[model samples]
Structures are given as C-alpha cells and as structure tokens.
Target: MKIFLATGNKNKIEEIKKIFSMENTEILSIKDGIDIPEVVEDGNTFEENSKKKALEIAKFTNMITIADDSGICVEALNGAPGVYSARYAGEHATDEENNKKLIANLQGIENRKAKFVCVITLAKPTGETYSFTGEVHGEIIDEPRGEYGFGYDPYFYIEEYGQTTAEMKDLKNQISHRARALAELKKNIDEILK
Candidate 1:
C-alpha cells in the first residue's frame, strides 16, 4: 500500500520514513513529485494542524495521507513557540534564527522545563481520519549541543540520555516525539490499511 506524507520538509520526511518503514508499505512525500499547494497551519493546536494537512492532501490525491505538526513547548513561556515553532522569530525563520530567539527569551529563567510534542493524523479519501500524539520531556539549554538532528534538537536536553536529540543519532529514531507517534500508528497499521 502507498501512503502519502503530506509535507515538504526534507528532515521531517527522512525522520518519518525511517520510523514508519514497513514491508510492502511505501511512503511518498512532496519530494516524490506530488504537487499540492501548501496548507495553511492556523490551528491553535498540533492535532488540528495535522488533521487539516492530512485531509487536504488525501482529498487532493485520493489516497491515504499522513500529516504531522510538531513543536517545542516551553513551560516557562506558557507553552509559547508551540504552534509557531517553525516561524518563532518570524515567518520563514531559519533554524538558527528560531533557536536564537528561543535562547533570548529563556535567558536568566531557571524553569527550563519543556517538551517536544508531535501529532500525526491519518486521513482517507473518504474523509475518515485518526490521530495519534506523542511527547518527550526535556529541558531547554542555552547552548546548542549536538552535530546532528534539526529544529530545536540541539537545545533540548534529555536528562536520561545525557545528550540532546541531535547527539542521539540513530537512537533518536526510537525515542523522539515523531518516532513515538509513528510507533502508535504502526500498531494500528493492519486495521488502517483494511
């Protein structure tokens, strides 16, 4: 069965592909020559955004579609940069820019509690949909500390691993927010594919 991943971000595509790998189940993304207009993410929550993207793409391609909306939510900031994680500094903000803005906003603040949240929505052409959510708790560090991963990975410190998500390398595929969410999806794959 073929599944359309409704996103153009290369990093997200790679991560999802790795976690959702299955025999006879092929995953395709925007990079696979699927031409669809970008979906606006004006939702107040991750689930809403994920469902919106999934439904839109499923309707357009008449295929089973999956979409995810994820972000770093800081407890101190009242979960700010939540839905706007991608464009925290501004629309089209680069990773570095968003990280910088996050650091600045967190300066001198002792409460560094934060969590990475991911919501995945699966949609069928008939508009039937299901959603899954996953989260990894961590603290926000002032200095970025890894050579791999993207987005807020370098700044997210996992106490148990003693390393940021970026430094975890392959281990990230097992424990990251997206990975956990995909794991949930995989558990129900048989029923969803029917």
Candidate 2:
C-alpha cells in the first residue's frame, strides 16, 4: 500500500520514513510527484492542524495520508511559540531567526523548562482519521549547539541525554517527539492499512 506523507519538509519526511519502515508498504511524500496546495495551519492546537493537513491531503490525493504538527513549547514563555513556533520570528523567518527570537524572549527567565510536542494524524480518503500525540521534555539553552537536526533542535537540551536534540543525530529518530508519535501510529498500522 502507498502511504503519503503530507509535508514538504524533507527532514520530517526522512525522520518519519525511518520510523515507519515496514514491509509491503511504501512511504511517499510531496516530492514523490503528488502536488497539493499547502494546508493552512490556523488551528489552535497541534491536533487540529495535524488532522486538517492529513485529511485535506488524503482527500486531494485519494490516498491514505499522514501529517504531523510539531513544535517546542517553553514553560517560561507560557508556550508563546506553541502553534506559532514555525513563524515565531516572522512569517518568513529562518531557523536562526526564530531561535534568536526565542532566546531574546527568554531573557532573565530562570526556568528554562520546555517540551517538544508532536501530534500525528492518519487520514483515509473516506475521512476516517486517527490521531496520536507524543512529547519530549527538555530545557532551552541560551546558546545553540550541534550541527545536525533543524528548527529548535540546537536549543533543546535533554539533560538525561547530556546533549541537544541536534547533537543526538544518530539517536534522534529513536527518541524524538515525532518518533514517539509515529511509534504509536505504527502500533495500529494493520487496522489503519486495512
């Protein structure tokens, strides 16, 4: 069966593909020749955005589609960048800009607690959908670290891992929020594929 991942982010696609590797099923993405307009993520929460993207793409392509809305929410910021994490600095802000803004916003704050949240939605062409969520707790560091991963990875430090998400390159796919969410989705793969 063909499973379409409704996202243009190559990094996300790669992470998801690695987690969802399975027999007899092919994971495909926007780069796989399926052209669909970007779905507006105006939802108040990750679950809403994930479901909207998955359902829209599944219906558009008449194929089962998977989509996720993931972001880092800082405790000190009161989750200011929750759903707006992608455009925290501006609508067209780059990762560096966003990271800078995040740091600036946290100035003088002592509590650096934060968590990365991921909500995944699996949608069928018929509108049937299932949702799963995962989160990874960490602290936001003022200085960025590592040379891998994307977005807030460099600033998200896991104490237990003793490294930032970006630094845990080889171990990311095994313990990331996205990885945990996909693992939950994988548990129901048989029913989803049927």
Candidate 3:
C-alpha cells in the first residue's frame, strides 16, 4: 500500500521514514510532483491541525494520509508557540529566527520548564481518522546547541539524557515527542488500516 505524508518538510520526512523503515508501504511526499494548495494551519490545537491536514490531504490524494502537528510549549510562556512553533518569529520565520525570538521573550526569566508535543493523525479517503499524541518534558536553554535535529531541538535540554535533542541524535529518535507519537501509531497500525 502507498501512503501520503502530508508535509513538505524534508527533515520530518526523514525522521518519519526511519520509524517506518520496516513497513511495506511506500511513503510519498508533496515534493513528488503532487500539486496541492498550501494547508492553512490556524487550528487552536495540535490535534485539530493534524486532523485538518490529514483529512484534507487524504481527500486530495484519495489515499491513506498521515499528518503530524508538533511544537514546543513552554510552561512559563503559558504554552505559547505551542501551535505556532514554525512561525513563532514571523509568518516566514526560520528556525534560527524563531529560536532568537523565544530567547528574547524569555530573557531574565528563570523558569525554563518546557515540553515538546506532537499529534499525529491518520486519515482515509472515507473520512475516517485516527490520532495519537506524545510529549517530551524538558527545559529550554538560553542559547541553541548542537547541529542535528530541527526547530527547537537545539535548545531543548533533556535532563535525563543530559543533552539537547539535537545533540543526541540516536536518543532523540527513540525518545522525542514525534518519535513517541510515531511509535504509538505504529503499535496500532493494523487497527488503523483495518
């Protein structure tokens, strides 16, 4: 079976591909000449956005489509940048821009408590859907670190791992929020497909 991954982010594609390395399904992306309008992600929550993207893409492709919404939620920021992680700095913000804004916003604040969250949704052309959510608790550092991973991974410090998500490539793949959500989805793939 072929599945459509409703995203244009190559970084996310690579990570998700790793999780599904053993699967027999072929994962297709928007970069494969599949023309579609840009998805407007104005939902209030991750699940909402995931559902919106999955359903829309599934309908457009008439195939099983999987979409995930992920972001970093800081306790002190009252979960701000939760759904707007991609554009935290601006409408067309880059990772570095968003990180800089986050640092500026939290300057002089001692509370670094934060968490990364991911909600993955699977949708069929029939409109039926399944969603899974996962989170990784950690602290945010003043400056970014590491060169691996994407988004806020460079600044997300996992105390237990004693390194940022970007710093621990192998560990992040196993314990990150997106990884956990993908793991859950994999565990129930049969039911979801059935």
Model 2 lDDT on a 0 to 1 scale:
0.93
User: Which of the two candidates, 2 or 3, achieves a greater lDDT against the reference?
Assistant: 2
lDDT of 1 by residue, 127-179 (tens): 99999999999999988899889999999999999999989989999999999
| Alpha carbon deviation, residue 157, candidate 1 (Å) | 0.3
Best by lDDT: 1
Candidate 3 residue lDDT tens string, 80-177 = 89999999999999999999999999999999999999999999999998999999999999877898889999999999988999998677889989
Residue pairs clashing in model 1 are none
Candidate 2, which segments miss by more than 4 Å at Cα?
A: none
Instruction: Single out the weakest 10-residue window by summed lDDT for candidate 1.
Output: 29-38
Candidate 1 vs candidate 2: the TM-score winner is 1
Better of 1 and 3 by TM-score: 1
Global Cα RMSD, each model: 0.7, 0.8, 1.0
**What's each prediction's clash count?**
0, 0, 0
Q: Weakest 10 consecutive residues, lDDT, candidate 3?
A: 16-25
For model 1, what is the alpha-carbon lDDT of residue 54?
98
Runs off by more than 4 Å, candidate 1: none
